[model samples]
Target chain A: MAEKVIAGFTVNVTEEGYLTDKTQWNKEIAAEIAQELGIEELTNAHWNVIDFLQKDYAETGKLPTIRRMKKEGGISTKDLYDLFPEGPLVKAAKIAGLSKPASCV
Target chain B: MKKLLILGAGTAGTMMANHLNKKLDLKEWSITIVDQEPQHYYQPGFLFIPFEIYSERDVVKEKKQFFPKSVEYIQAPIKLIEAEQNLVILQDNTRINYDLLIIATGCKIAPDEIDGLEDGWRKNIFDFYTFDGSVALRNKLREWEGGKMVLHLAEMPIKCPVAPLEFLFLADWFFNVKGIRKNVEITYVTPLSGAFTKPRASAVLGNLFETKNINIVPNFNVSHVEAEDNKLISLDGKEVEYDLLVTIPTNMGDQLIERSGLGDELNFVPTDKHTLQSKAYENIFVIGDATDIPASKAGSVAHFEAEILTENILSYIHGKPLEAHFDGHANCYIESGYNKAFLIDFNYDVEPVEGTFPLPGVGPFSLLKETTINHWGKMAFRHIYWYMLLKGIPIPTVPPHMKTSGKKL
Candidate 1:
């Protein structure tokens, strides 16, 4: 396990860079993570997705799906991709400081 | 007593052996199946290894486990097939004479045919077709830092043509789980004009690609892999660069087909498309990935061919005109990631159409549409492959022929 220090607080991550603890994730940590992920600034649209994901994970204990985001979170697939060019749900969960989703590839 | 020799105890060979053992008169005939390798693989399971959906042991089994007590299993690599003399020469220089020969010696990946592909194989390039290759790719993907990942197909007529698309879909999901998908730029490069061989299926698959944000680089007839530049040069002078290349190299039939002087330019045995009888030899039949048929090189096609070939072989033995005919029928489950998959069933004449499968209106599976039921169907097939299909038991509802009863248009 590799640990990343955010605001002088240590956070453990898996070898693949997924955060091990959900509690260590904060708004400040997300901002730093977003910048590191090539998103220089976090827009309101990005926060909407990130905040929804955090709430969804806390409630369901499952990562919100792409369809769920599009339907419930009011985010379109295109806009989701635009926001997180790599992947929407994946990056949203990461930016929100959630653990890796348990979906089988 | 007459001898029936079947080469390569893979999917086609194993099914034929089991099928014939029950049909043939044991008192008057001897059946022998040969292969250099002793392990049998449920090849479809190979695609799931890199995604961590299936482990290595889940896909491998002893070749002898599928064979019955009556069939002879020879574990030796074949050196040559003397088609004229009806003799198969082993690598040890021994000869086995047969009255009828069945060539199921399937195709293999030929990376050497592509220039510079070997230069970075297993380093920056990998394939999930073979067991070792799949395992190596699993490790590479597990530790893969985000970069431009390109999944490519060198040519068509490769085994399990839908596999590359499945890999792409799984990669989308895999990277998502790893939390580095944002760092990865995924692209699919193919020789075809679209995502698949068939137009209807291609349209559906192409849409999936667009929604997934995976780039599509079609009609790329690869000339070579310029490893130094990290570019795949097409014959048309086009190039696509990537940091990691996972390719399905040019696939060719077994070397034994070439040694026997019985194969086409690509070393696939030329045969009657419907009858599966070799064009050159009357007593010889070819099936599976070894034949130069227009059907998809897949296990389902082989299973379908085995049913027709078994009947044709019996007809030939009795000096009867061959009655059963293969329709080049093939069906496959395409895993579309996110625990959903789609099913496609087609033949030489039909493209995959939208509808329900097995039961027209009451399908537990859908055609050309992704569903969780389809994913379960794909998972359940592993057991069906080992217990029923390879064992030659008739699979219910799924016949050897492609019927249009359930298809929409």
Candidate 2:
């Protein structure tokens, strides 16, 4: 893990830029990370998804998959793609201050 | 006598029954297994059926033949699992109480989950994930002239995660042998970002795809199948047209899981990844494709899980700690066609890397690289699965856990 400054706050991050310690995240950090990942601005719709992801991860201790996000988060796949662009789950999870969703390898 | 009940007489349940039968004292514990089907299918052979590599006779056997005489087998559909009361009710309304339960009801392909898919199913679209589907696809391939052949995966966490890749690889070799390789256009479409789940394996297999003239369309999360237009439309509006579509549909656990109110959104029981125990109930355990573990849903995974689960069950029964843990161990053989295949060994922590298996440096079977010997090893596994694995007998050299020796880090 390496320390990086995001939104004027230093935090630990993985090599892929995901927050290592989710507790260090805040709204400013999420918006900054989102902007860095090419999401121009965080809309209310975007925040809804981020909230769902963060809440689900905090409760389960595991990042929800794209399927779970669609089914439980009450978001359509089309909307997720529209909100986060390419690779929606990875980008949303990163912005939500969670590790990348683990794919069954 | 205390009762030990096993649901679903498939690979995992059957293995557990055989295991507990020998381990549990007959004077103290009685074992009973339940399933709807009488035939035990060798699921890995389903991949070979489309290529005509194995016939129906080769992959099928009576489920009763594999079970130990001490264990009672009930051929009936499960209606519901009353977890709170430790009672399982059958379709005939027969209720059985158990001191402990093991759920091994595996998953199956659900084509109806996708819009417009059922319209073309068994017509322009086909699947080989089931016995009848494989046989149907074989008949379809036997007479069909070559055209655009698209192999698609509707979603992730399907049983035998590498089967679709293997199917494409074998299809390339199949068409070539049929002298129609030039006439057929082959493509692989998946929601994943690459050819395989692991980065290293994906790179290796991606290079092979290039060599074999196969095309790949990644990150294409399919929204629906347009049967009339012969197109697969993504949620983002991207489209892929095909002459023949071979798809791995959305795989979900048994409907009984839903009926019993014991599953998640996908109907897979919430399970503890390490202990193989049900997260909600202490006496109820889960194994194989039935659980929502992050491991690949394959028979090899179930085999590895059976070993750890047996020890854990015994520990639980004896009022000891559930110390034995499953590391999500999965060993699979990918048939790349033409008597060549690749072997992979991994778990929840380690991704499959280039290594020698079983004997470490002295391996007769190589891992992560294509070899002719691996092909033979895969072929030989059918016999081993029948004679040893399902019977709860350990292989001579292979262990249940992943070994890090002789691996290229």
- Top model number, TM-score: 2
* Candidate 1 CAPRI grade: incorrect
lDDT tens digits, residue span B1-409, model 2: 9999999999999999988888888899999999999999999999999899999999999999988998999999999999999999999999999999999999999898899999898998999999999999999999989999999998877999888889999999999999999999999998876675555666566588889999999878888999999999987888999999999999999999999999987889999999999999999999999998888899999999999999999999999999998998899998998899999898877888888988889888998999999999999999999999999999988889999997886
Question: What's the true lDDT of residue B175 in model 2?
Answer: 94
* Reference-based lDDT, residue B225, model 2: 93
Please provide, for model 1 over B252-279, each residue's C-alpha lDDT reduced to its tens digit, 9 standing for 90 to 100.
Answer: 8988888889876568887888899998
Provide TM-scores for the models.
Answer: 0.79, 0.95
Q: Candidate 2 regions off by >4 Å?
A: A1-29, A58-63, A97-105
Task: Calculate DockQ per candidate and list them.
Answer: 0.01, 0.43
TM-score of the B chain in model 2? Answer: 0.99
lDDT per model, in order? 0.85, 0.90
Clash statistics: count for each candidate: 0, 0
Which residue runs does candidate 1 get wrong by more than 4 Å?
Answer: A1-105
